[model samples]
Target: MEQLLDEFRSTMDIPWSIWSARLVGTVVLCGLIGFEREVDKRQAGIRTHILVGLASALYCIVMQHLVVSDEFATDRVRTDPIRVVEAVTQGVAFLAAGLVVFHQGNVRGLKTGATMWLSAAIGLACGLGLWGLAVTTTIIAIVIIVLFRKIEQKAGTHVPGHKNAGEKEA
Candidate 1:
């Protein structure tokens, strides 16, 4: 058991504490955003947001590690951070697409899809150790969801299964 534990520990280059912080922070921030969705009964609620945020954070961490490894290599290897971020964005876009549905001339789940995208961003921020950015983003997201919901209700702008206030289902 000692040897097994040693071998497992040897596989990780970064400290466990750093990884734990990133993962836990991502989960907590994303979970808060997810809670708003849960209250509103959105399809992609807590679990989905948490999973997306966690996975995105893991991806960011791996990408950062890969860049650092390349930086210290004997043979120089180019590492483009933009490409890594673009890949992450594409992945999150795919996940968000899964939540969207078009039916009977109406689109559904737009807000939920946007929420998932925001969750990914929050995860990336946490992974990069930008605690302030992550926290601020989460708070802004909650405000947008809650405040906009109220505004929509008062303005009658956010109609279910409809494009706009004046658009009727066909």
Candidate 2:
């Protein structure tokens, strides 16, 4: 059993230390962003955000390891990691589409959808060992999602497009 575990770890090509760090960091980042969404009662809150981030990070690690393997190395082999980014973006678009609703002329969950996309990007950064970037981006995203909403609401009164609450536009 121990041998099998060791072999599996080796196949993943991540040192246990680094893997543990990545896991913790990804979870923290996801939770931080998710907490903001949860406070706003968003649909894709804690679990959804964490799952997306962790899965994307894992996928990135696997893809990178495979591309760098000895057997796959060729004299002219070209492996562009951007392909992974593109694929993840395309796939996440489908997830985002599902969050959109056509009823009542109200579009909800758009921020949640965007949060998922950013979570995935953070995960990719974590997978590539860019801890500083991932952490900074997560903090910035949280601030934007939480703090900016309040600012926008307060400033809405003075903004031209936003009329007083009880007043209808002419």
Candidate 3:
């Protein structure tokens, strides 16, 4: 059993500690962003966001490892990380489409859909070993979702369409 474990660990080609740290950090960052979405009561809230982010990060890590291995074995390996980003963006678009609702002549969930897109980007950053950027971006996203929301509400009241029906229009 120990031999199998050792072999498996060695085959990964990355330090176990670093891999674990990256995984945990990615998960936590995803959860933080998800939590903010949950507070907003969006359709794709905590679990959905976290799952998407984690899966994106995992896919990136696996692709990177495969690319590196192919290079070491002198095989024809194309190292195009942007492909992963493109794929993730496409997939997130599908997810975002589901979150959109057209009713009462109003469009809802657009911001939530955008948030989902951003979350996937953060996951990609984490997957590409950009832990600091991912963490920083996640923090910024949280602030935008939480703090900026209040400011937007207050500011929106002054906008023509957002005012009460009695308000005069220019």
Q: Provide the lDDT at 81 for model 3.
A: 68
Model 3 per-residue lDDT tens digits across residues 1-170: 99999876666666567666666777888888778778766667778877888878877887777777744556454577678888999999899888777755756677778888887888888877898899899888888777777786677632222323235666
Error of 3 at 35 (Å): 0.7
Under the 3 Å rule for N, CA and C atoms, how many clashes does model 3 have? 0
RMSD of 3: 5.6
Residue 63 alpha-carbon offset, candidate 3, angstroms: 1.2
Of candidates 3 and 2, the better by lDDT: 2
Model 1 lDDT vs. the true structure?
0.83
lDDT of 2 by residue, 48-107 (tens): 888888877887887778687876688777778888888877777789779866545545
In every candidate, how many clashes are there?
A: 0, 0, 0
Q: Highest lDDT, which number?
A: 1
Question: What is the TM-score of each predicted model, taking all chains together?
Answer: 0.82, 0.80, 0.79
Minimal lDDT window, size 10, model 2: 157-166
TM-score of 2: 0.80
lDDT, each prediction:
0.83, 0.78, 0.76
Sorting all predicted structures by lDDT, with the top scorer first, yields 1, 2, 3
Q: Runs in model 1 with CA error above 4 Å?
A: 1-6, 11-13, 70-72, 158-170
- For model 1, residues 120-159, the per-residue Cα lDDT tens digits are 9999888878899999989988988889889987997766
How far in Å is the alpha carbon of 150 misplaced in model 3? 1.0
| Model 3 stretches astray by more than 4 angstroms | 1-10, 71-79, 155-170
